[model samples]
Target: MLNSLLRISQKTALTLVFGLFSGLASAQATTYYFSNSGNDSNKGTSISAPKKSLAAATALAKAGNKLLFKRGDAWYIPFGLFDLSNKSGTRNNPVIIDAYGAGDKPVISNLNVLSDDGWENIIGTTTWKHAIYGYSKALRLFANGVSKYKVNTSDKLANETDVDQPHEWFIKEGVINKNGIVYMNTGSSLVAPKNVEVLMVGSKPVVLMENTNYFTFRNIDFRGGSTSNIVNIWAPSANITFDSCIIQQGAGSGIQAGHSGQGDLTTYVANINILNCLVDKVWSDYENDPNILLSGDGIFMLHAVEGGLVQGNKILNWGHSGISITSYILGVHGVHNLIVEMNDVSGGESAYTHAIDMNGFEGLTTHNIIRRNYFHDYTVTGHILGSYNQIYSNIFAGVTVTKMPRHSHQGWGVDWAVWRYRGTGPWIEAHHNYLVNNTFVSTEECAIMIQDSKANPIAVSNNVIANNIIYNFGDIAIDVNTNVAGTVIVQHNNFWQENSTEPVARFKNLGTKDVYNAAELNLVLPQYFRGNTQFNPRFTDVAKRNFTLTESSPTALKYGGTTQYTSLLGEDFVDYFGKKWDPFKPSMGAIQYNGGD
Candidate 1:
């Protein structure tokens, strides 16, 4: 009798435990579908009976639930707003928004259209403004889905000091009245609204993520907006991801991750990953570039964010820079421990822009890694690095067809590399950075140019540059503009020929002597120059486009342990020879003699 009672109790306890587990698992997860034909009145539990509006379906979402929009559908949210409030998802099970029933990707855009009645006839073609869109952020002017030209003006103008430059439209309140005006200079002396259709973005984002965490968006085509980027993250959210999506037609910018306040690094935005997405046309015709800062950027991440990765995105045709890893910390600020890799950023060759610009003007942005990216046709600075930044294993190429008219002698053709700044730092004036093992196939200028910009700039010491290949530089291999009084460690690199008759290094700025002048160029001279070899790396075949060094190449041979730049990035990592190579005999450049990536 006792044994029977004990066995019955044990079976009951096990059954209760399994029931609790099952209930928790079921409650924590669900799959919700959405279609235009469906009604919001349904429970949206199955694909057959789905919800109609994304906003209504989003309201019912919980953590770990999946919300899939019907493919081949378009949902124009009112006021371009898809607001999220007070929701959180863990890294293990994030709230997902993706597409279903594969065909064309589902699209979410703004529904508000600009009426021709709001635009009035203007007398002088200098400026045109219409306040149809909420008069904040930036705006764009488009005709038949193609970007049109704006009038160029050089006056004290409205808010931006970077005035006199070209803009498609300029929006300002009280310009004509309190309603705000949209300035349009279509290049004609007396401009009138033509037969072209026009669309304007109001002051709201198409997708706004606010005070939320761990939301994943995938396989969606986000389009249109007269105000700002398609998506905007306004809080210190974590694990926010966007993958396999198309972000197009941004008025101000493509995407902005975080904002700066109080210069506090503690309340940072973290763990944001933007991967495998297509971000295009982040161009603004009109912007409040007040003081000449803040314009259209494809992807802009700011503030001190730890643990982030930006990889495998094709960002193109931005009005300003493509990737702006920048901050606006009122006082000293920071951003560290991030990986930006495997991206193709191109076609952003505006006269006043660069491919990637990490603006550390507010504070120190350190320990960021940029590698394995392809940059083409960016006429200005290809890449600019601040202190504690690493630039390695990338290709910067400029094609002949896309080459602008800016490559004349004494112009900005050579672009720049490892361009340093000095507000304050630990390593001399500007230090703690590394440029290693990259390939530059430039057609206009030298391989690398170090510019301080101002007259008699201060020290740039304790930085390391090693094992890189620079080809097709027009004039000189290395050109230092302002005098750099600090130490810069340059080691075993290859500077190949472009114009054939060009010299190797052009120091001492002006009429330039052949010698490396320390005092004149404000450099410490040979003390900063360490074991950098200027020779042909001798690739297998230049015509066949085989860039790997041949066995007969001098750079293919052994480099000793004493020549290793182990102190640079705090790692004894592998380069051309891979990680398993004998440490004492490391080869030069990014491409190993064995031709491995």
Candidate 2:
């Protein structure tokens, strides 16, 4: 009887240990936390009970776990990696890692891991040590041994240390001691230090999704530091949505899809919706390094099987183009509905590039609608290189295309073209686009310049350009120079307050020119410039120099038109001082002047 009782007790103890181990193994969901003052085993559930690092929580978290961070707690992660590669979760049950507690607004501060010595090394080698050029390069070369050096076209120097093998170094200190000791004092002499600048190194992408599906990242903030992309959704990540997040300060693009190499290409990014997000301040380390070229874009949708919707987002301040769509080099075409609407894009000119760019080859960018957005204050062209596209209802202000001598090259202005490949294809319809009532203020050259020089058989027809208010422009409002074999129409456009001394409409060898061309060709310019009046447009308060049209002004009901104008003169217009103004009727210009009190 005693022996039997002891056996039962040992079996019960073994059973309890087995249960605990099983629970640890199948921990499918759990809550974790992070705090600077916390240890690795501190429950990791809340602010008071937090984990020491994000890595510690992520390692143990399963598919349906929540890695909640403490609010207002700043962490310094030098080179952290949150690998969600092997984890698979449903859309309803996603792995949520977010800031928690205190109204759930976590401020994840970006950690600057590099020291001053490292920064000095990067600046010296890249010739970015000083704001001005040439002088910085010369100083770097002299410090690194000019006798073994060679200068490149961009004034960057290269040299060999012991043998003829190429080596580069920057001056960390201006002076050096005879004992070969390195100090922070001035006049430090030449020697390649063991510590190099922490250049962001990985091209593997910060958030890489491979052979994964049904994923969603919401309300997360991805701050920048490393050289890798913020998010890389390869062919495997189909049916993904990134909503209401801030993806900023990435060394590469904010979001990049598709691989660059030629392979089996089994993975294809499709059904992706990036909505209500802010993708801004995406720059490249190559911008500082003269040896490398900046190739990626802010949102690169390449070779997608079913194109997606990119809406309600502000994509600004990028190193390269804002948005780019293209086909693979192996002639694999992908299409079906790409809708880019209601986006506010600006400041895409780091090296004189575009804000929104699309390059489609033999694939269709068809049924794509780019409408109702505000693109302004851009140093380069706002839009470029698209086909079968509908571009309408957009307000373009302060768009400078001309390359001023001191700023950029002059030939790099915005030219709306079908493709850069010069492939002979038919021109698509650019019609009913309320290029009207939108403002084009302080533009360097043509507001709407169209070029169809590629002997492509495409025609530009049924396009309506009417009642647009243009002011302080440097060149013609509409300039079409195309070899298109079809009849292109331009009618009922209001070219108001143009600063160009040239003709408003310049067409090359097209028979069906009307309106102003009609008198020259013995036909009427098909539209009316009637009660649609233009003056200083009577901005309210002369001291403020506001441009909002008042109610009793001539622009009120004076806009005589049968077709409904999409934009009123000042539809949701605001002054520089953030004052709101509305016009009485559809005002004739881009800005509706509200009359003074």
Candidate 3:
């Protein structure tokens, strides 16, 4: 009996000792500080004794630790921090990289500033020459913190003017072991070498994470990458979050996640969050190359990604698409369940670009949600080949497709706000997509298009376009080809044209048939074409792009009521201004008018 009592006492003591050690281990998670003025030999636990470089801090970092950099300083990380791979943190305690002090977010860049005296004036011309490196064809140059225009060759310098100004540059190749010369012309002004910076392009990303999980990067400025992506989260990476970060001036994309090489479901990247971020000025070599369909994008998600959230971001000046979820390899399950909402995008600055390009591997992208986004001054809003996607409550304005003079043989025609065209591959049809409660205003072309060439075998079918406000479109309201006549159901919407005595809702080309009158629409598709009204929506301001309805508008109070496609609209009934409405009695456009009639 005494021996049994001693064994129980020993077990209890061992348990207590283990608990104490676990608590100590949890408390030992440290906060490493980084500053431009500190030394690597100093202890990085405190701000006063901080690590001088990202290499020093990353070497000593463990899971559940914080890596904080000084707010006003900057670091030139030519080689990325590769030690972050294979790091995992717990759910409650994520490995965070954030700013510590005030001023600005810490800048991590690959841009090298040029010296002031290295420039030599080219005699008898308004140009200057500077030697950067040995004959590299790809160099991203910025003058006075702005991306400069790169001409095709030195002979085309005079012809390559930018917006009525003569500011362009060209690069000359050098011999082996010799430096290449960069020629610059600023319209007769002397070039300042100190104001210029360059990022040598050799496919080097700033942040490359492989199998890293549960990491959060906040309030950091990542810029000037010469690679395909500025921040790349490789395959099998999960739970990575980027909040309030500025990702700019990449040769390819701002952020590219997931692996195009992975095939298995378990090896897919998952739960990547990009919130409240600004991605600007991502350019690539393929942007102007007409032979290549891919362009430099704002955010590019590769194959085998699931359950990611991209919200409250501003994506601007992208060369191709603003956001792309793509899969290249066959037999791979594509990107799905990505909630992209409340983002402001302006793109299509390069050849044949769309705002959102989901026309990747056929039949792989499914169950994606694109809601409440504001797209303006772009060519196309969505070039979708995906299925079972929900696109609702979004505003598409100023969709003007630019005509490229170089690719004039291609005849880059106008496109609609949302285009559901034929897929590139076999057995992949665009089907079962939903577009509900959206607003289209001041578009250069039509509002919505569901069409394809007759040669494609796959049929676009089972799509629903309901409860939308198509107003002030330059061309037709809804254009559906004869090939997809009976497939799409268009109903319960308000359509109006600006400044016409007879507001003939120009919903046209349902198999080459135009339905100008409501009675004609009812006669064409009698069962589905109910409650579609053609009247002025009575907006508060059209110039300011505000689509809020007035109190006396009939579409706001009377025409919009119960929808037949209730289940198709997602659970979120919030409007553009963040006001909730009853799902059963939803209003016509993106904004639910709350005022009494």
Which numbered prediction scores highest in lDDT against the true structure?
3
Q: Model 1: per-residue lDDT, tens digit, 1-597? A: 211111111110000011111112325578888998889998887989999997785685567789899999878653546776566665556789999997989988763344545556455444344554343333345543455433322233544222233345454544332245555544454554442323343546777775678778999988765445767775456677899898876666787777546444456556677888888874433432322433467887766555577777888777566787765453433566677766777755343445676645423566777765665566556444556777765666663322333331222322323333343432212356777776666546656666553432434545666667777666666676655444556665666674323356665644446544212222334555545545566666655434556766764333421235545544524342223234456556555455332
Evaluate residue 141 in candidate 1 and report its C-alpha lDDT on the 0 to 100 scale. Answer: 52
Better of 1 and 2 by lDDT: 1
Q: Rank the candidates by TM-score, best first.
A: 3, 1, 2
- Candidate 3, residue 37: Cα displacement in angstroms equals 1.4
Window of ten residues with lowest summed lDDT in model 1: 9-18
Residue-wise C-alpha lDDT for candidate 3, range 1-597, written one tens digit per residue: 211111111110000011110112346578989999999899888988998887876675566789998999988764343347777665656788999999999988876656668878666566677786643454567766666666652334433122123346666667643457776665564654447767765647778788777789999998877557788888777778899999987767889887858455447777888888889864433335443334477888887787788877888777667888776666665788888777887763454456777754466778887777777667654655567887777887777655544422211112222232334444444778777778888766667766654555556777777788878775567766555533666677777885433333344445435545544664676666666667788877778777777876774433474466565554464666555656567788887787753
In model 2, where is the ten-residue run with the lowest total lDDT? 9-18
lDDT of each: 0.58, 0.47, 0.67
Q: Once all C-alphas are superposed, what RMSD does model 2 give against the true structure?
A: 14.7
TM-score of each: 0.72, 0.65, 0.85
